[model samples]
Target chain A: MALKPLGDRIVIKQVEKEETTKSGIVLPGTAQEKPQIAEVIAVGPGGIVDGKEVKMEVKPGDRVIYSKYAGTEVKYDGEEYIIIKQSDVLAVIE
Target chain B: MALKPLGDRIVIKQVEKEETTKSGIVLPGTAQEKPQIAEVIAVGPGGIVDGKEVKMEVKPGDRVIYSKYAGTEVKYDGEEYIIIKQSDVLAVIE
Candidate 1:
């Protein structure tokens, strides 16, 4: 099943953290906080403003950096997906 | 000191949770996660869209609901505030 966001909503899939630390130390899930990094998977069409459409700056393939705590996490089809507005995105990664 | 948001940025002050629960239970900080509720304190003038300015729908006095994990938390002048884009706002409380 595909989830479609309304307005300027975006769907992102979080990047899983590495199981082993840089020093080759295995870390458990409860060791520390979960990583919040994510990859943009889909975006809604441009948002409507004053009878006009505002195009988005980021695209589907763009890797964006957003607020670590900025989005609603939802489990769809047994996969975790985050729904955030375009404005929540802080920067685009090259 | 006042925080001025640039472009579509918005400044919000988180609402502190009550110390005592409804049943008069004093919960510790570690007992549960912190409440993510916030109140909009200030908003940017407007957002630039397609060479035009799109006026914001929300205002300073409006209570807005946003993603639980959305926005960067910043501490300024001994106070905590969140800087998020207007698009991060999901709904307005009437």
Candidate 2:
């Protein structure tokens, strides 16, 4: 990825929610809500923000849950990526 | 507010998009995009996440620009409020 996030921002590639856990069952796109899980591709260096020291805890290759609809979607190289601040991330999945 | 956000979560009251700037001019809600501006009504306690120390910067009463569609809407006593993670906030308005 060519995009590097600044501040506490990170680049994410959304994970498509599985609709076909059982064989021959296709639950259609409309049935699924917007995907909130994503994999981190790039991470920004954390620094002073509003005069407070901020340290980045999540890094590249981390799976995270972000706030729903909490990012600016970008299309790069024919693939979709979403950039969101570190704070938008709800939790890191191990 | 009776609700307190845990971790980096926050409660925000959305700002009404001014559609009637010109006198007697009314724009339909359907024609307008989702509002992104909101006032912070509650703040969360920040602590270690992923082994990195995090600090809270924005506080209550700060006007912020959050990611569009980034919050869970709630109705409290006939008023609306949105709860979102701090990372969902894009910028703080001076």
lDDT per prediction?
0.61, 0.66
What TM value does model 2 have? 0.45
- Candidate 1 falls in which docking quality class? incorrect
TM-scores for every candidate against the unseen true structure: 0.43, 0.45
Name the lDDT value of residue A11 in candidate 1. 75
lDDT of prediction 2:
0.66
DockQ of each: 0.04, 0.03
Q: Clashing residue pairs, candidate 2? A: A87-B87, A88-B87
The true-versus-predicted C-alpha distance at residue B71 of model 2, in Å, is 9.2
**What does the lDDT read for residue A41 in candidate 1?**
75
Which regions of candidate 2 deviate over 4 angstroms? A19-35, B1-94
lDDT of candidate 2 over B1-94, digit per residue (tens):
6545546778888766563242233333332334366789888677854345658889999988777444565444456666677877878878
lDDT of 1 by residue, B1-94 (tens): 3888887778987655562222122212211222234578888888675466666766787655455345788998889888887766654434
Clashing pairs in 1: A69-B69, A69-B70, A70-B69, A70-B70, A71-B69
Report the C-alpha lDDT of model 1 over A1-94, residue by residue, as the tens digit. Answer: 2545545767787655562233243323332333344678777666684446757787776766666444565443457666677777777757
